[model samples]
Target: MKAPGNVIGFPRRSFGRASAGRSEPADATDEMSDRLLAVAEHGDRAAFAVLFRHFGPRVRAYLLRAGGDAGRVDDLLQETFAAVWRKAGQYDSRRATAAAWIFAIARNRSIDAFRRERRPEFDRQDPAFQPDPQPDGEETLATRERAESVRAALAALSEEQREVLRLSFYDGESYAAIAIRLGIPVGTVKSRARLAFRRLRAVLGGRREELR
Candidate 1:
């Protein structure tokens, strides 16, 4: 299935160049939704193909705009579509348009990728990875002190800033998702997170310096 002109036109260098000079129909959004439903209900290959052609480039563009590298963008595009295929039954046209549903999947895939990159790799050879050993007096006291410090830092934040930080880091929610949940703008979520982190770093850094 050929994508409509409206669906094409991501940067030429990002993925392969798309065909120029095309346009989508007025009923394109509804049409896409119907195709997704067909795939969900009947496992329709043709309908799935059409949906892919239509949304693939747009999803690629969105991922790139979200700061994904070329390699990561391609992988995320595949992951996002795979999720769409698997979750098509959950799509509700009354609640969200097909494009909205597909893009939300893409956004979540991007967030998962980012979190994976940020996570520290565990080493099998490290003693810490071995069966747990009871902590001695110094170790136990140090652990308690660190936990107390973190708790104090968190307590110092304003309610809004603390909530944003909790949703972002602890709950692993994307800024866009948090914004939707909080009924605030995405920019506000980002701003609150930034302020919260800055405050945390200042407080934690001071504590470390005193310990040294």
Candidate 2:
């Protein structure tokens, strides 16, 4: 049997307890977003525990989709939540729910890690040090929410469709690139992407109408 702190090889349950001063959240019925904001506003450890318990696996999966290796995924997951702990104060619920906010942090951190890993050497003249332009707050929020909607829609896709979409869109790979990486034919890659996009557009359109 696994140990108490063990969570699918992440070993975070004990860390959550130590940081939050409570056991990990066992309740499945809890609303996590409001609880996460409560942690942000009041430094509530129990709320933190709930947030970690709920979002940890999803964040880990997000990191993997962004091309994070198995070796670094755990470290990246820890760093992602640590930033959440520190920057939760900056979270704006009017713009993003707790889940979207968490994902944005994870995505940005994963990109940073990917850039660092891909650089063979550091040079002062390296353009990597130059800051990329940031989207304005409203634009950033919209992008994050759109990403959240896409992620939700992805869960509804067939696994094959989901895998192709993740590689092409999230990892920014071309059809040929994904074919080589996945050891599949280029035509099949294009087919998968076309179908995935069609599904995503339908799903997102329905979601927009529901919001009205």
Q: Give each model's whole-structure lDDT.
A: 0.70, 0.70
- Please list the residue runs of candidate 2 whose C-alpha ends up more than 4 Å from where it truly belongs after superposition: 1-30, 57-74, 89-97, 116-159, 168-174, 185-191, 205-212
Instruction: Name the candidate that leads on lDDT.
Output: 1
Q: What is candidate 2's lDDT per residue for 119-208, written digit by digit as tens?
A: 243433467775334435543434335546756888989999999987876676779999999899999999989998888878665434
Model 1 Cα lDDT, one tens digit per residue, 1-212: 54465233322321221122125333355566667777777566667778899899998988786777999899999999998888788775544567767877787777778765654445445787763344344433332244346678999899999999877764567899999999999999999999999999787554344444
Per-residue error for 5 in candidate 2, Å, reads 23
Model 1, residue 105: what's the lDDT?
A: 79
Which ranges in model 1 have alpha carbons more than 4 Å from their true place? Answer: 1-27, 116-212
- Deviation (Å) of 146 in candidate 2: 11
Q: Specify the highest-TM-score model's number.
A: 2
